[model samples]
Target chain A: MESKRIEQLLNKYLNAETTIQEETILSKYFTGLEIAPHLEEYRALFLYYAQSKTEYSTQSIQLKTKKQHWKWISAVASFVLLISVYAGYLYDQNKQAEYAFEHTQDAFQLLSKNLNRGTNAVMYLENYKTATGKVFKELN
Target chain B: MNQAEFLSVVMPFKDKVFRMAKRLLVSIEEAEDATQELYLKLWKNRKKINSYKSIEAFAMTMTKNYCFDRLKSKQASNLSLVHNNYREKGLSLDSKTEISDSVSIVHELITKLPEQQQLIIQMRDIEQYEYEEISEILEIKPTAVRVALSRARKTVREQLIKQHNYGIKEN
Candidate 1:
């Protein structure tokens, strides 16, 4: 009776009308130890299908790197670019500040030198006037 | 989806993609290359991958198309597949060779079949995909999938029975 049911299922299987469940049942029957002799050739056929499912390529897929790497590279590049631009701007401002400081120093030195010279001249003039007044008083 | 979700969804079926490619391509090397190539392309469009209802089916279809393109290119250069030369390793040589021989015979017979039937058998029988699933992958009607699959099985069965009875391998 079971064989009769399997035979009917096999017919449907060969016609491709059986459900996947029926096909699975047929596969199990054929792959089992006791395949019907008349259906022996069909055994290899089902066996082949089972064997083929495990026939995957040994090559590993390493798609993790390439596109993701490019994204990281571009992000790093822009980051470096941003840092360099900001650094250059900071350097320029520092240079301008240093130049302004040196210019102010030079201007102060020039003013001090002129003022010292004027003070020296005024001291000499006062000395000359004092000496002339002493001589006139002695003559009177 | 994002990378984690994408990998979880796709990596499980990555071998299935490779197997599908192997079915279409000539050698293991070609199939591996095709699988990697298909995955890379999928990665590039991974952002839109979630839009697909069944990413596994989509990837299978992509693998099929990519491999066929490679096949066509090979054909354009006047090259053809040399079937029946593949060796299954790691088996103790003497005992299983006879069975493997039978298996190889069936494999050659499959390759000799017309393209549509070959793919139909691969999808329906070997991959154990549902008829509706095979129809979706192959872009044919469900009834048409059954018809083509039946015809392919019959061809295999006839040749296999002939081999058993006559002990002669014939195309």
Candidate 2:
């Protein structure tokens, strides 16, 4: 409290012999508004420290990298998902086309077989007409 | 730890980290950047945060290392001409300028000290760290820390007295 005692503490502080509590006393002493004239020179140093303690990072913290990385991963994942969905769609379309073509081929083969039978039947009928006319001619 | 937990654990000392960085660095912007970078790192290593006895000390050590590395960079040296430039709003212009001048003088005198002493003062006086904590941050013996801090404060005190007596660098 007294300048004499403060001076003693300050000396101890300069020697780094003071305990943490004692050092706090010195810091608190120098920090007051009314410093003794002889000790005024030391005021700025303590004031600077006190002033610095008040200095803080007012800018809001933005830990962007981690969030950005997760965003990037999601983007890539969605991109892969889109590609897979498109690929699956294309594969399904291809299978449906192949199945329909196979059915059409089977139906065309059946149609051609029946058409061949019809052709053979017409040929037999034509031969029968010609033979029947010949027999008629012979009879005539 | 997760963001909320990491923030709760480390947020209390973020300003302390900022001040430490500000002390080492020449500019508030650089200090702010360093503080953010330090927290980002702490966040990344949040899982390991519990391993250290005191997260604030760990953060201060990280801040010290980061700022020192920054000081070595060409840009930081260029920026060293600037120091704390904040204002006490209600003061008259003359006293404001006077206080600012005195503040810069102490700050400049501080910057000229050997880097170790300057760091010790910052840790001991400005940051008010425990001797053990300062020792851990500086990676030195507690006795050595006390010696360095003594030397640092004496140098500043003598220079300040000389300046006040003769007005040598006042212009």
lDDT digits (tens) for residues B43-146 of candidate 2: 88888889999888888888888887876774546743333242222123225445677766787788788878877887778777889989988888999998
Give lDDT tens digits, candidate 1, residues A6-74. 889878887888887888898898889987777778788888787878766677777676877999999
Chain A: TM-score in each model = 0.52, 0.59
Q: Model 1's CAPRI class?
A: acceptable
Residue range B1-171, candidate 1, lDDT tens digits: 676776787888877887777777746777788888988888889988889888888888888888888878877876433433433322232135345677777776887788878888887787778877888887889999989888888888899998888763442
Candidate 1: which stretches are off by over 4 Å? Answer: A64-140, B80-99, B168-171
> What is the CAPRI rating of model 2's predicted complex?
medium
Predict model 2's lDDT versus the native.
0.80
Residue-level lDDT for B134 in candidate 2: 91
**TM-score of model 2 relative to the true fold?**
0.68
Q: What DockQ do the predictions score, one after another? A: 0.47, 0.52
